[model samples]
Target: MKILTLHGINLNMFGKRDPKQYGTATLAQIDDQLRALGQELGAEVECFQTNFEGEMAERIHRAHTDGTDAVIINAGAWTHYSYGLRDALAILKCPIIEVHMSNIHAREAFRHVSVIAEIARGQIAGFGVDSYLLGLRAAVSAVQQG
Candidate 1:
């Protein structure tokens, strides 16, 4: 199966941005781990990282035409407010699993709400980078079950 992985906003600065909250792994390192996990599961993983909201939306739009079977996205701050991202996700026929590195609910009040969760197949958060792997696994399982 083909899975598209998207990293949004400040996530590109993962390791360097906040070592306490986001851990010490760079975005590239996280992608490497996810890619390894995907290979182990016999799935092809294509990843994209963008700080721009419109670019992320464009990637989501492209996923539909790229034969993507599922999508795993960590929309950073966009999780709380980007209706455009939610709308892009809504348009996809495939399953989408929203992921967060930190537990948003435990953070600032503003981080507690996720606009994208309303339209996602499921959400995985608060497990650090494991959230991405877990989301991917869940997405793969959902695709297989369907």
Candidate 2:
């Protein structure tokens, strides 16, 4: 199965943004780990990240054309209010999983709402990098079961 893992907005600055929250892992490091985990789970993983909302939406559209079997997205701040991204994800036929390194619910009130949650098959948060890993495992399992 092919799983597209998307990181959004300021996520590229993960390691430098806030050590208290995102930990010290760079975006590359996180993707590399997810790829390794994906291999063990028998799924091919492709990762993408962009600060631009339009570009993120475009990538989601491309994933549809590319025949991606599942998607795991951590849309950063966009997770709270980007209806456009949510719409793009809604277009996908495969399972969509939303993940976050920090617990949005435990943060500021603005961070508590997720526009993507309505369309996603599941949401995993507050477990740091493990959230992404779990999201990947969930996507793979969903595809295999389907």
Candidate 3:
């Protein structure tokens, strides 16, 4: 299966960002973990990170054309707002799994809402890098059972 993993907005700064919340894992580390887990799950994982909203939306559009079987997204701050990304994800026929290293619901009020939730098949959060790993597994499972 083909899985697209999206890291958005300021997520590129994961390691340098709030270590208290995001932990010390760099974005590259997170991607490496996803790829490794994907391999074990028999899925090909492609990860994309972008600070630009339009670029992310465009990437999601491409995923639609690429016939991606599933998408695992940790859309950073975009998770709370980015309707553009949500709309792009809506175009896909495959499963969408939203993930967060932190527990968004337990964070600030502004961070509590996920615009992507309604359209997503499921959500996994609060497990640091494990969230991405779990998301990948969820994506693979969703594709298999779908």
lDDT of 1 by residue, 9-112 (tens): 98989999878789999999999998999999888988899988998999999998989999999999999999999999999999999999999989999999
The TM-score values for the models, in the order shown, are 0.98, 0.98, 0.98
Winner on lDDT between 2 and 3 is 2
Clashes, model 1:
0
lDDT (10s digit) by residue, model 2, range 1-71:
89999999999998999889889989999999999999999999999999999999999999988989999
Model 1 clash pairs are none
List the lowest-lDDT window of 10 residues for candidate 2.
17-26
List the candidate numbers ranked by TM-score, top first: 2, 3, 1
Off by over 4 Å in 3: none
| Candidate 3 per-residue lDDT over residues 24-125, each given as its tens digit | 999999989888888899999999999999999989999988979999999999898888889999999999999999999999999989999999999999
Model 1 segments more than 4 A misplaced: none
lDDT ranking, high to low? 2, 3, 1
Residue 75 CA displacement from its true place in model 3, Å: 0.9
TM-score of 3: 0.98
- Candidate number achieving the greatest lDDT relative to the actual structure: 2
Judged by lDDT against the true structure, how good is candidate 3? 0.93
